[model samples]
Target: MIAKSPLRVLVAPNAFKGTFSAFEVASAMAAGVRRALPEAQITCLPLADGGDGFRATLVAAGGGRTSRHRASGPLLEPVWARVGWLPGRSGETAVIELASVAGLARIARPSPHTAATASTRGLGELIRAGLRGGPAEILVGIGGSASTDGGAGLARALGYRLLRADGCEIPEGGLGLRQLHRIESDRVDRRLAGVRVLAASDVTNRLLGRRGAAAVYGPQKGADRATVAGLEAGLHRLAEVAGRDLGTSGLEARPGAGAAGGTGFGLLAFCGARLFPGADLVANACGLDGALAQADLVLTGEGRFDRETVPKHCAIVSIAQRAAPNGPGSPGAL
Candidate 1:
């Protein structure tokens, strides 16, 4: 039976991968929902949980602006990465997504051995630049990275030194591990400590193992079978060094440890950041709960709804359902 009332509907959706942006998905869904309930008050909120489309999705959902920041790219080029700032009461917060700077998308075919050196150094520069303006908060989205250097490149850019046991500096990129040594973080930027760092990710793979970053994502980055094995071994050694130097263990199995290669572990270990679902952060920004409170119906969609799309991918369905009214004549769920 068709139910009629002065109903409120909320439409929030994530990206459908390479096809549509979250904003576009939400808009399309909202159109369909409005067609179903012509008189319903519909609120379209596009969301992202720190994946490839995080910045663009958030900028579209909220009144935000995108700016270009020069950063190190997957190939070590000085590339201009897209960063966004969402308007807030305590001034605007800069959304710096590592994917924008060091994402797998940026990696091209005919990749270079230097590609072996691809690092998150550019992401760190973008973060530092965002803070140069003294923004309220720095929200870092870590996902889709092309490098697997344990975020050593990022640490170096932030003023930490990756030194060999002989005190020589380590080169940038994952292959730099061939010159493995100790780590020196005494010179890391103190300003970073004063600001809040929030890491948004969905991966839970550790830093090293059969389930580690290299073994799982190496092929995606164009690593050959032998290269993968080498990277796996290197990561194990790196983790051991980290544990010995930092005096902490369990980084190898920490949820999101495999995010952006190994930057997830690096950020948690060094930056003192709290890791949360990319969807949760996006939900809070878009006020999904508040919209749901007023919503009688909900509609949503995503790029792919499959096994690989865990934690973050399910957010669309989950949030939409949670926001829908639970009554006999309440809105229909889709």
Candidate 2:
């Protein structure tokens, strides 16, 4: 940034972990800047890594609005999720966060078997509501999910069938996948025909294996050893069936396919959604590139700044990198 008077200052920051949201941080920073330099021009743009505060950040930056939609929770209870709506065709793009509707954070008194029985049905329902607007695209942030069902609940809620050997419908949840005999998709929604779905996540784990969704994220969802193994096996079965029936063979191994307890793979196989880095997705949606181009001074913040900041793909680091395209540790400048 130059030492000129009336400088253009862009304030962008992530949540301060457990303390304040990015918006709060930006507000305080802007207030302080105003007191110190009354003539300066300041803009506040709060950001997130497609997890906490995703809806607010994206909607505010993109000049959008938010609406509430009733949907099922991770445990099958009714809940209202806030979805961000941006200008689009019939629907240019709809933004949603899985955490808001069906996340572990909302679950109180989680049982030992929560991981096995949790579902992403509500997330699928949220998508259904967004489709009602006739949007050309749905941008979903698949983070903080409460299930490990590999998105079976999502597919099921979206009108796909998971049949057992006796031609009975398989129960929803990871444990239920053990009885999954085949997948039948004759009833899927037709509105999904040409609509595009983009999932924002930076998770690189695949759908099955040591580093896969089950083994890596299952424990965090309250899974025991046996439950983890069960979840893993269930995801494997889902992959096998999807590969054979939907011809989505080997997609389970795709990076990020295991995100959100394998909701990543579920979106891939069922909705044909593409996974993107959360920070990059947010930057693009909010037009951060344009903001950077016009700003003379930029500021980004978080709870802690360390070695893991950049590698973790936090929005704070995304701002820094875009501000300085030349290279390493040049984030403080453009």
Best by lDDT: 2
lDDT of every predicted structure (CA atoms): 0.75, 0.85
Query: What TM-score does candidate 1 reach?
Result: 0.85
The parts of candidate 2 lying over 4 Å away from their true place are 1-8, 16-20, 29-41, 89-91, 294-297, 302-310, 326-334
Which residue pairs come into collision in candidate 1? 16-303, 49-278, 72-122, 117-173, 204-256
| Regions of model 1 farther than 4 Å from truth | 1-3, 6-8, 32-40, 59-67, 86-92, 110-115, 311-314, 320-333
How many steric overlaps are in each model, in order?
A: 5, 2
Q: Model 1, range 64-117, lDDT digits (tens) per residue?
A: 998887788877788988778889888888888887788877776625353467
Candidate 1 displacement at residue 159 in angstroms: 1.0
> Which pairs of residues collide in candidate 2?
88-92, 91-135
Q: In model 2, which range of ten residues has the least summed lDDT?
A: 325-334
